[model samples]
Target: MSSVDVTTVGRGPGLVVLPGATRRARHYGAMATALSEMYTVHVVERRGRGRSPAQDSSYCLDAEISDALEVLTETGSKQIFGHSYGGLIALHVALRTDLDRVIAYEPGVSIGNTMPRSWMPRYEQLLAEGKDARAMVHFLHTCEFMPGGALVTAMVWAMQRFAAEGRATRELLPTVVRELHEIYALDSDGSRYGAITAPVLLLGGGRSPAYIKQMLPLLVDVIPNAKLVVTPEFDHNAPDLGHPAAVADLIRA
Candidate 1:
């Protein structure tokens, strides 16, 4: 049985939903609720967050893959809907298991040197200094998630320290660096993904980072049975926050 804390809702064939870095299972409540009408939704809290245990010193891509597979095995989930880093995990799982379908939303797959790294130094330094809020701003700014100028970022960071969710999110801030590093560690050209046998849908946002959107079609070209769809209505955080119901519609399609 997987030690992972999976939020189960609805009933029918299962669809495991893997959250992105800096995300807990509950972050998927809305999406899971929407998909619940059609399928049993298992929103898994990847190891290191919620009730799940942390990854050991030897943790790597295999560790994440193992955690995800355990949930799949325990849930008998034949389909998966992975967002952000979770999308990256789903693609890896597709290589190991014959899933019914794989829906990846802005998957964090780093083909060659495409994944951005210029902000790592500052973000990691800020984290090392115990300055998580600053690190978040840097991440958001660099990843194009939070757009504005320095004054706006500074103002937002100042306000974040007062919000409950912001404070809660601070606890998972380190996981961002850790998970992104994992992405970097496993970075590769699209060659390995070509073997994924399941039918794949690469969903993207019209407003996400240029790099993220650019990776979609390339992935569609690589994954044998994959196609691309860019939802002009949503951004990178759509599945988790903005428009989860619409994202569920994509998954349902």
Candidate 2:
């Protein structure tokens, strides 16, 4: 909570963004640039990537919340947007703090063991053995991408070795494991989210994983002052990777 890495942009009311697991501050460069004209966007480089301190022995979701609170307090910002796992953190932060608005972009909220944990054992063992690329296979398998058979696995392995995503995903395999654990540990039936006081916007990608799509509707129903918005032209990684400009448009709307 002391000195976290944050990439700041723009000149208006501050809006903090938390990237999903394995994503770095620079991964959101395009999004930050798109939103800069309207809002001072502070894209946090969450722990373990970039210049931020690595996740230690006791890292957990609570630790993530503490770091986010520091960003909000330091910037005097009350608005937040979290992508994927970051969305989950942003929502939980609102549960414990006051905020003017909260936007969760396809949050990885696990409803009653919906976020699969079966891949953990093999993934962890491969990571411990220094087989990071191999470990990525197990995690990607859990993603349940339709028709993601041998070709997808082959691409995952090749990406680890050749693609620039090697660092963004393959190299950060260790952190992804930890983040997934946090998701699984918080599994519930969406009841507890009723405590969030801020008016919420549950942003989702129409083309994202089916489980992700399923989770958002239940979230809208539980949060007292929340609404659901889906962008059909987008997917799970749109905010940082593909549709930042359009996503920014939604944030200001």
Candidate 3:
């Protein structure tokens, strides 16, 4: 297997953070910094992003879990925090291994076809047409959070600026598409998660879509040691977005 890139920040007990579909560990700078104050933060740059090698044909959810396991073993971090698709990966890891604690923020587990089956094809078409920005916009719109008009408009503007500035959000499109496919392909039942023995803190956002919010209860009911917490003031990207401090406080608590 290819080597995974792990970046360390702060000082204290080991804490590994797995970012969402964005797969950009650097984007979690604020949250890592905050958590670093209380724990040594090890951020894993998922394959196809940052310093991690690009994904090959063999890439799959198992590969992601393996990458995470390697990081956990290398860092000896028993505590993990995962957001979005990363959360699903973390949960899977906990199910198969013994982890002290897990804190997941809106894992992209589908329950009752939470994701529209038509989205993948539409997103692929946009990518084929070289409309990466539009593809991202559409992807966000379809997300469980269903970002509103203002947020969507702002994201479009930001994406446009990034493209103009040569930062090109388009570069990350393939990884985004692949991860979305992975999420959609997953079966929604929490029955398998019942085997996880680690204590879990399932978090969601009040402003997030009903589907996203609904996962917390199902997860809590299935995972014997799980609890749910909703941060009413934030949405899906709480840690990397506006409420890193709030999220950090929760982690610390």
Candidate 4:
């Protein structure tokens, strides 16, 4: 098994965490810490970020699932929470592994043409033009399910500014793009998930995009042991860094 570093916190039964496209385990510190009060939270840093090793010559979703499985094995964790793309990974892991419970917050699973294929070229163009921040912003504008309006524009502008001021966002751009591509490549047919017997908590933010809301019902219908929870005020990032305490509460409940 591949050796991966995990950030552990709190105490009790083991709980493994997989972050989304950010891939940075530390971003979920607040949520992990809160969960730690009830369970030993093991935050796994996705490959190509934090202390985890860089991506190999070939990158595939299976590698990511393997990484999570390795961590779960190492920690003896049977419960997991996956945010965003990480949620997608967790669902797959639950199907293949012996997990008691799984929580997926907006797994980014696209059905048919849910993913905006037309934006790829413009995103790549911005990246190639040395406008990494703009590329990130453009990507967000294209994918985020929330209402774009001025709020999104402001958010994108702020993200661009933040990316310009710091190296973290810029450094993570390539990884984000790569993972997004992988997500798009995934088989969107929800039928495969019917095989997952473990109890699943299908979570979505009320403020998240309509597509995400649409996905929850599909997942719940397909996964016989699944239920849905919608946090009306939270968006896609709630479980990661937005509302850690609330998310922790859900996990604990």
What CA RMSD would you report for each candidate?
A: 1.4, 1.8, 2.6, 2.6
Stretches of candidate 4 off by over 4 Å are: 145-166
TM-score of each: 0.95, 0.93, 0.91, 0.90
Model 2, position 3, has a per-residue lDDT of 69
What value does the lDDT take at residue 101 in candidate 3? 95
User: What residue pairs clash in candidate 2, if any at all?
Assistant: none
Candidate 3: residue 102 lDDT (0-100): 96
Q: Better model by lDDT, 1 or 3?
A: 1
Residue lDDT tens for model 4, 1-253:
4466788998899999988885478788999888877899998888887678777669778888999998888888899899988898999899889899999988867765565667778878887898765676677777764444566656665665666434566667777667778878874778889999899998888888777787788778899899899989999889765798899898889
- Residue pair clashes in candidate 1: none
TM-score of candidate 4 on Cα atoms, chains taken together? 0.90
Question: Better model by TM-score, 1 or 3?
Answer: 1
Q: Distance from true position, residue 45, model 3, in Å?
A: 0.8
lDDT of 1 at 192: 92
Question: What global local distance difference test value does model 2 have?
Answer: 0.86
Task: Name the top lDDT candidate.
Answer: 1
Writing each residue's lDDT as its tens digit, candidate 2 over 1-253 gives 4468998989899999999987888888988898899889999988898788789888999988999999999998899999999999999999989999999999989886667678789888988997776677667667753334567667777877888777567657788878998899899998999999999999998888888888888889999999999989888889888888888888889
Better of 2 and 3 by lDDT: 2
